[model samples]
Target: MPRMKVLLISLAFVAIIGSLGAALYFMMKDSGDKPKSSHMARALAFRVGFSILLFVCILVAWKLGYLRPTGIPLQG
Candidate 1:
Protein backbone atom coordinates (compact mmCIF):
# COMPACT_ATOMS: atom_id res chain seq x y z
CA MET A 1 0.00 0.00 0.00
CA PRO A 2 1.19 3.51 -0.84
CA ARG A 3 2.08 5.63 2.17
CA MET A 4 0.46 8.74 0.77
CA LYS A 5 -2.77 6.95 0.01
CA VAL A 6 -2.81 5.53 3.48
CA LEU A 7 -2.18 8.93 4.98
CA LEU A 8 -4.92 10.51 2.92
CA ILE A 9 -7.42 7.84 3.87
CA SER A 10 -6.51 8.24 7.51
CA LEU A 11 -6.92 11.99 7.28
CA ALA A 12 -10.30 11.63 5.61
CA PHE A 13 -11.49 9.29 8.33
CA VAL A 14 -10.35 11.73 10.96
CA ALA A 15 -12.12 14.56 9.19
CA ILE A 16 -15.34 12.59 8.98
CA ILE A 17 -15.23 11.78 12.66
CA GLY A 18 -14.34 15.34 13.56
CA SER A 19 -17.24 16.70 11.55
CA LEU A 20 -19.60 14.34 13.33
CA GLY A 21 -18.26 15.41 16.69
CA ALA A 22 -18.73 19.03 15.77
CA ALA A 23 -22.31 18.37 14.82
CA LEU A 24 -22.92 16.74 18.15
CA TYR A 25 -21.32 19.63 19.95
CA PHE A 26 -23.47 22.15 18.13
CA MET A 27 -26.54 20.12 18.78
CA MET A 28 -25.91 20.17 22.51
CA LYS A 29 -24.73 23.78 22.58
CA ASP A 30 -27.54 25.38 20.66
CA SER A 31 -30.50 26.75 22.61
CA GLY A 32 -33.09 25.56 20.07
CA ASP A 33 -34.37 29.10 19.62
CA LYS A 34 -31.79 29.81 17.00
CA PRO A 35 -32.52 30.65 13.39
CA LYS A 36 -33.41 28.22 10.65
CA SER A 37 -29.76 27.93 9.65
CA SER A 38 -28.55 25.63 12.39
CA HIS A 39 -24.87 25.06 12.93
CA MET A 40 -25.51 21.45 13.86
CA ALA A 41 -27.21 20.86 10.54
CA ARG A 42 -24.32 22.50 8.73
CA ALA A 43 -21.84 20.30 10.55
CA LEU A 44 -23.85 17.22 9.69
CA ALA A 45 -23.94 18.29 6.06
CA PHE A 46 -20.20 18.75 6.11
CA ARG A 47 -19.80 15.25 7.55
CA VAL A 48 -21.94 13.81 4.75
CA GLY A 49 -20.05 15.79 2.12
CA PHE A 50 -16.73 14.64 3.49
CA SER A 51 -17.92 11.02 3.54
CA ILE A 52 -19.08 11.21 -0.09
CA LEU A 53 -15.92 13.00 -1.16
CA LEU A 54 -13.80 10.39 0.60
CA PHE A 55 -15.64 7.59 -1.18
CA VAL A 56 -15.15 9.29 -4.52
CA CYS A 57 -11.51 9.91 -3.80
CA ILE A 58 -10.92 6.27 -2.99
CA LEU A 59 -12.68 5.22 -6.18
CA VAL A 60 -10.66 7.64 -8.27
CA ALA A 61 -7.44 6.54 -6.64
CA TRP A 62 -8.27 2.94 -7.36
CA LYS A 63 -9.08 3.78 -10.98
CA LEU A 64 -5.77 5.63 -11.25
CA GLY A 65 -3.87 2.58 -9.98
CA TYR A 66 -3.04 4.10 -6.61
CA LEU A 67 -5.08 1.65 -4.56
CA ARG A 68 -5.83 -2.05 -4.70
CA PRO A 69 -8.35 -4.19 -2.86
CA THR A 70 -6.69 -6.76 -0.63
CA GLY A 71 -9.69 -8.51 0.83
CA ILE A 72 -10.69 -12.08 0.16
CA PRO A 73 -11.89 -12.69 -3.36
CA LEU A 74 -15.48 -13.81 -3.94
CA GLN A 75 -16.12 -17.37 -4.97
CA GLY A 76 -17.15 -17.46 -8.59
Candidate 2:
Protein backbone atom coordinates (compact mmCIF):
# COMPACT_ATOMS: atom_id res chain seq x y z
CA MET A 1 0.00 0.00 0.00
CA PRO A 2 2.77 2.39 0.90
CA ARG A 3 4.58 1.54 -2.29
CA MET A 4 1.47 2.18 -4.32
CA LYS A 5 0.99 5.51 -2.61
CA VAL A 6 4.58 6.47 -3.31
CA LEU A 7 4.24 5.50 -6.94
CA LEU A 8 1.04 7.44 -7.39
CA ILE A 9 2.50 10.55 -5.79
CA SER A 10 5.64 10.27 -7.84
CA LEU A 11 3.65 10.02 -11.02
CA ALA A 12 1.59 13.03 -10.08
CA PHE A 13 4.74 15.03 -9.46
CA VAL A 14 6.11 14.01 -12.80
CA ALA A 15 2.93 15.11 -14.52
CA ILE A 16 3.05 18.43 -12.72
CA ILE A 17 6.60 18.98 -13.78
CA GLY A 18 5.74 18.00 -17.31
CA SER A 19 2.95 20.55 -17.43
CA LEU A 20 5.36 23.18 -16.15
CA GLY A 21 7.87 22.26 -18.81
CA ALA A 22 5.23 22.46 -21.49
CA ALA A 23 4.27 25.91 -20.30
CA LEU A 24 7.83 27.08 -20.45
CA TYR A 25 8.27 25.62 -23.89
CA PHE A 26 5.16 27.30 -25.19
CA MET A 27 6.22 30.58 -23.67
CA MET A 28 9.54 30.48 -25.44
CA LYS A 29 8.12 29.21 -28.71
CA ASP A 30 5.48 31.91 -28.89
CA SER A 31 7.63 34.87 -27.98
CA GLY A 32 7.57 36.68 -31.34
CA ASP A 33 4.86 39.06 -32.50
CA LYS A 34 1.84 36.79 -32.25
CA PRO A 35 0.04 38.33 -29.34
CA LYS A 36 0.33 36.34 -26.07
CA SER A 37 -0.51 32.70 -26.58
CA SER A 38 -3.10 30.76 -24.62
CA HIS A 39 -1.24 27.45 -24.70
CA MET A 40 1.14 28.45 -21.97
CA ALA A 41 -1.68 29.75 -19.83
CA ARG A 42 -3.63 26.53 -20.24
CA ALA A 43 -0.65 24.41 -19.37
CA LEU A 44 0.00 26.48 -16.26
CA ALA A 45 -3.63 26.19 -15.25
CA PHE A 46 -3.46 22.43 -15.61
CA ARG A 47 -0.39 22.34 -13.43
CA VAL A 48 -2.11 24.38 -10.73
CA GLY A 49 -5.17 22.18 -10.80
CA PHE A 50 -3.10 19.02 -10.73
CA SER A 51 -1.15 20.33 -7.77
CA ILE A 52 -4.33 21.08 -5.85
CA LEU A 53 -5.70 17.64 -6.58
CA LEU A 54 -2.49 16.04 -5.37
CA PHE A 55 -2.62 18.02 -2.16
CA VAL A 56 -6.22 17.01 -1.57
CA CYS A 57 -5.45 13.39 -2.27
CA ILE A 58 -2.63 13.38 0.25
CA LEU A 59 -4.80 15.04 2.84
CA VAL A 60 -7.54 12.52 2.31
CA ALA A 61 -5.10 9.64 2.48
CA TRP A 62 -3.79 10.89 5.79
CA LYS A 63 -7.30 11.25 7.14
CA LEU A 64 -8.19 7.75 5.98
CA GLY A 65 -5.02 6.27 7.47
CA TYR A 66 -3.25 5.46 4.25
CA LEU A 67 -0.51 7.99 4.83
CA ARG A 68 1.35 9.59 7.69
CA PRO A 69 3.60 12.58 7.97
CA THR A 70 7.28 12.05 8.71
CA GLY A 71 10.19 14.41 8.76
CA ILE A 72 13.29 15.44 10.62
CA PRO A 73 13.17 15.13 14.39
CA LEU A 74 12.61 18.23 16.41
CA GLN A 75 15.56 19.39 18.50
CA GLY A 76 13.29 20.09 21.44
Instruction: Give all candidates' CA lDDT scores.
Output: 0.85, 0.90
lDDT of 2 by residue, 1-76 (tens): 7888889999999999999999898888845755446788999999999999999999998999888778887898
- What is the clash count of model 1? 0
Instruction: Superpose all Cα atoms of candidate 1 onto the true structure and report the RMSD in Å to 1 decimal.
Output: 2.2
lDDT score for residue 75 of model 2: 100
Stretches of candidate 2 exceeding 4 Å from the true structure: 30-36, 72-76
Reference-based lDDT, residue 26, model 1: 78
Question: In model 2, what lDDT does residue 11 have?
Answer: 100
Worst 10 residues of 1 by lDDT: 28-37
Instruction: List TM-scores for all candidates, in order.
Output: 0.83, 0.83
The candidate 2 region of ten consecutive residues with least summed lDDT is 30-39
